[model samples]
Target: MSQDRDAGARLGDSSLLRKLNLAAALGAFLKAPSLTLRELRAVIGVSRPTAEDLLAELLTEGRVEETTPPRQPSSGRGAGRPARYFRFRAESGYVSGLDIGAHKTLAVVTDLRGNTLATSRRELDPELDAAGRLSAAVETARACWVEAQLAPSDITGVACGVTGTLRAAEGVHDVGHGPVGSGLAPYSLPGFTEVDVPGALSEGLGRPVAVANDVKLAALAEHWKGAAQNHRDIVYMFAGHRAGAGVLIDGQVHQGRHGAAGEIGALPMLGWEAAVERLHARGAELARSAGTAAGREGEMVITSAARQDPESLAVLIEFAEVLARGAAVLALAVDPEMVVLGGGMSRGGPILAEPFRRELAKFTLVPLEVVTSTMGADSVALGAARLALDTVFAELLAVPGS
Candidate 1:
């Protein structure tokens, strides 16, 4: 018996070692997907027991689950049991997404699976400083937690999408379009200097925070779950609370060399002063015709008029036409598969789609499909949470040999 055991030990074909390596690979597989055991073994290299042990650890921690059990042939001569496959628990933790707009800030709480559990919104005074507005946004997020019956500890991280420009080192700056800046509009709030909105938000929630442009966040959300899903390349154009855009290429956000990939709003649609004047004029016209209440009812009137009134429709078509011109330039540069229209303006789908498509077709020969976002106002918040989840998974996968 001792001789036989010795022979068995000597006959080690390294199958055990392979399995151990596979176990280590399982952790990385969980983070994303579509990894075969063979691929894992090549990368991690371990015995079967070690692999099994790693899988067991993940199972015990509830961090992984069998998404697709291994397939085995019923009549195979050497087959015993099927290999079990596992994946990360995408619903395990929750992340918070905050979208700060010109008039309000919205916060949404979602799990790793992108399921929203609660949401909150607070109207802004426009007169409030950056710190005050951020504080209000934090409070609103806490309220959302309460509404969802969740404690602050339940959150993993917070992601914020803001208007205006941001610098990596100095953080979000009230530059170009703030009260003190020469571009966009005037916003006279103090702390208008480079303020780290994300850092402040991270401190407030006691977790790390991610920051993005509001338009970019909307684009991310749409790319993930709305109109742009399955499109590897998409351009998201937002025409509300000021016009801006976000570009997605190969399923990743493209922020450009200076993190200004989609700063289309600053693309000199007109001279800065002319653009601001046009904005004010447009706002005033809408106010007089729609009672200037700036509520849903007023917006409806503006939309309704834009539809029935040829003159009004022409004006709107012109907006879409210029936007299409912008999109044409984007297509010439990026050549995305789809262009998604979002924000309050997108609520008028057909009102804008046909004209934009027609105009865009005139400029670019690329067969680009244009569509309206169905995620509506929730897109940014949803995208923020998704971004946070992605960040967490990326960190997990970065573990050595994971």
Candidate 2:
């Protein structure tokens, strides 16, 4: 039995072992920032020779860089040799994230550590065609990088969040294109149905681009840095121009088979479509009552009305209840511990949250800790940045499918 166990241990793949060792060293450097070879050897619990070999490997890949330490003072006997230190090069490359919506496009640039160095938002011309809109998104992305004094060449990867199902060949189109349901606008932008979004963005940005459903990216943002951090399972509901949920299960965003898992609002039977419709209708009413622009009905309008007028408050409550209906169904299916309310409507604060709780309570058997997204309007773009970093780290670390 002892011989057999020894044989099993000896049979371990040497290349895989080295990979694990390098990854461990890289992780340690990221946490420690600056670590000496002796400190890393102790932390990694490896022989000095093995640690030296791992450090060389990382240095070769530029994943880690060595630094000269300040001269050490002489001890009672003699001067101790100053050991060289290494640090994780978190800014070795940059990434960009874009959130493409009907009304506007938002872009963010970040370093490898996910620090938002700059951002830009541009409203779309409703009259523009698909090509024009794509140009606008590229322009905004360029503007963000310019604000950060970076060129597109600095970007290692780019990920985008858009308001519909993404088929690389078919571009982005609302689920309404199929009987998947509606409340979403049709693909009115000429040539949009065949735009090749990722390809277009890649060409415009001079790097490969990945596209994801916007609501799903919102969920990813919440999981990455917002209220859902560390929780494996969460439901991120976006209640702005449209209401939808981004689901995370077992610590990963659940894209499902075709990436349309949390699109319940598409079902008119769910009442989510009417919910948003009524909110806008009430906003127009309140705007007129306040002697404001009748057509100026949006997230702010709902929040203002809910806060200032009794009748508007009632409308907001109903609106929140309608969203709760969809959320209730999602919760029953996913049983997530956290639900993050986000998007433009979430700016309404308690106006949306309070009534959402009241209605969600009726259907849920257990208490769900609901919170608002701190990323605000930047949620989707930031989430896309997270995705871009994953891609960057995967290639940088030489780990496949990161």
TM-score of every model versus the real structure: 0.79, 0.84
Give residue 321's lDDT in candidate 1 (0 to 100). Answer: 75
How far residue 82's Cα lies from its native spot in candidate 1, in Å, is 7.9
- Tens digits of per-residue lDDT for model 1, 1-402: 332234346656345433333344655665455344444444455444555666676668776777775455676455576545567676667788888765677899887667788999898876678788888888988998889788888887778888755667767654324334465553323464547677788888787888876777788899888988889898888765455678899988887766778765455653333433344455557667766554343244346556586545655666677777777877888989989988887787777778888988998976788888899788888888878878876665453421
What lDDT does candidate 1 reach at residue 334? 92
Q: What alpha-carbon RMSD in Å does predicted model 1 have with respect to the real structure?
A: 6.4
Scored by Cα lDDT, where does model 1 land? 0.70
Candidate 2 at 172: error in angstroms?
2.8
Give the distance in Å from residue 5's predicted Cα in candidate 1 to where it truly belongs: 23
* Residue-wise C-alpha lDDT for candidate 2, range 59-160, written one tens digit per residue: 888878887664567756447775688887877789999987777889999988888899999987555677888889999999999999997788888999
Candidate 2 has a TM-score of 0.84
Alpha carbon deviation, residue 64, candidate 1 (Å): 2.4
Among the numbered candidates, top TM-score falls to 2
